[model samples]
Target: MYKRVLLKLSGEFLSGDSGFGISPDTTADLARLVTGALGGTGVELAVVIGGGNLWRGARNGKGMDPATADYIGMLGTVMNAMALQDAMEATGQPTRVMTAIQMHAVAEPYIRRRAMRHLEKGRVVIFGGGNGAPFFTTDTTATLRALEIGADVVLMAKNQVDGVYDSDPRKNPDAVRLDHLSHREVVERRLEVMDATALTLCMDKGLPIVVFDLFQEGNLRRLLTGERVGTLIES
Candidate 1:
C-alpha cells in the first residue's frame, strides 16, 4: 500500500505497435487504464514520461551535439504529456502537465510546491521535459521528481514486460524472472531496471521501486494496494 506514487512510463507505451510516434488510440487506452486504476483508490499519482518514441537522443543524434539532441527529445516528451493529459481529462481524471523547461503557453513550469499542491488536490501530475537538463534520462527525472515530492515509491511501468529478469526474457526463454532484489544487487548486477544513476539515487535515498507491466489489467491498482504484481527492488 502506498500513499503517493511516481509512475515512470517509457515513451514506447504511447507509440503502440508502430513504435515511432504517439498513437491516439493507444494513448487513450493507456489514459483509461491509468485513471481506472486510481478511480476509487486514495493514492496520489505523478508521472514522468520518456521521449524514446519520438526521439532517442543517443540513437538519433548521429552528427548533432548531444545536448541539442537531448533538448529535442525533451520537446517530444512535452508533446506526449499534453496528449496524455487530454486523454486522461476526457476520462474525467483531473490532470496537470508540468514542464521542467518553461513553456508558459503550453504547460505550467515545474515548481516543486505547486506540483505537491496539485497532488494534494487530487490532480494527477504529469512531469515533462526531462528535468530541464540534458544528458539526464527520463529515468533520472522520475527518481528526482519522486524524491522532491516525497513519494512513497517509484513505479516503473514497462510496456509489456511483467518484471525484471536475470536476462532478456524476449531473447532468452531461459531468462529467470526476479521477484525481489536489493538496490545494490540491481546496480551491481547491471540489471535493466533503471539507469545506473537513477538506481544509485534511490539506493542512497532509501526509495523503493516496483517494475511491472503497465498494460496488465488491474496491475497498477494491485501494486498500489500492496499486492505484489512484479519485481520489487529496494534497500
Candidate 2:
C-alpha cells in the first residue's frame, strides 16, 4: 500500500445534482466514502480541492480585474474546504483545513512543516486557496503540495471520468480510455490529466499521478491496494 497520498478533488463532485454550490448530502456521502476507504489503511492522506463549483476564475473574470477575480475564486475554495472539513469531521474523521492565504480565524496557514506534521499525526490535511496566487489552477496546487509533503502519489479524483481518453468521452463515444501513459506523452499530447505546468512539474520530479473516478465505489481503496483502478501517469 502507498504510504502517503494526495487526493485532488474537483468542486463539481461536491455539488451533486445541483451542478453548483455545495450539497450537504453529497459532501456527507463523499466523507463517508473517503473515511471508509482510508479507515485502517494507515495511509497519510492530504487533499487539494478545486473551486469550480463556486467560482471559475477565467469564466467569472469577464469584467472584473483578473487578480481580484482569482482571489475571490480562492476564497470560494476556502468555503469548500470548510464544508469538506465539516463533512469529514461528522464521520469522526480528523481533518485540518490549511490555506495558502492567511485566514487564522477559519483555517491554519499552509506551512510545509506543519502540514507534514499533521499527516504524520494521522490527520487528513485539506489544502485550500490555490497556492495563494493568481493565474494558477488547483491542479498545480495539488502537484506542488504533493511534492512538498513527499507523497508517494497524487490521486486525481474525477467526477465521472474514469480515466484519460484520447478525446472527450462525453462528446465522442468512440474515445478510447488509456490505462497507462508516460508524463512526457501527456505533455506532448496535451492530455487533460492536468494543467501543463503541473504535469511538467510531475514529470520533472517523478511524481506519479493516478486519475480515476471518485464516484466509483471502492475505487480509492482499490488504488491504495495497488489494484490499478484507473489511469496511471508517471515516468
Candidate 2: segments with Cα more than 4 A from true spot: none
* Candidate 1 lDDT score at position 183: 98
Q: What's the TM-score of every candidate structure?
A: 0.98, 0.98
C-alpha RMSD (angstroms) for model 1: 0.8
Whole-model lDDT, model 2: 0.94
Q: Write the per-residue lDDT of candidate 1 for residues 1-235, one digit (tens) a residue.
A: 7899999988988998999999999999999999999987889999999988999988999899999999999999999999999999999999999999999998999999999999999999999999998999999999999999999999999866899999999999999999999999998889989888999999999999999998888899899787998999989
What local distance difference test score does each model get? 0.94, 0.94
Once fitted onto the true fold, the runs of candidate 1 whose alpha carbons sit more than 4 angstroms away are none
Cα lDDT tens digits, model 2, 1-235, are 7999999998887898988999999999989999899999899999999999999978988899999999999999999999999999999999999999999999999999999999999999999999999999999999999999999999999878999999999999999999999999998888888998999999999999999998788899988776898899989
After best superposition, candidate 1 residue 198: deviation in angstroms? 0.5
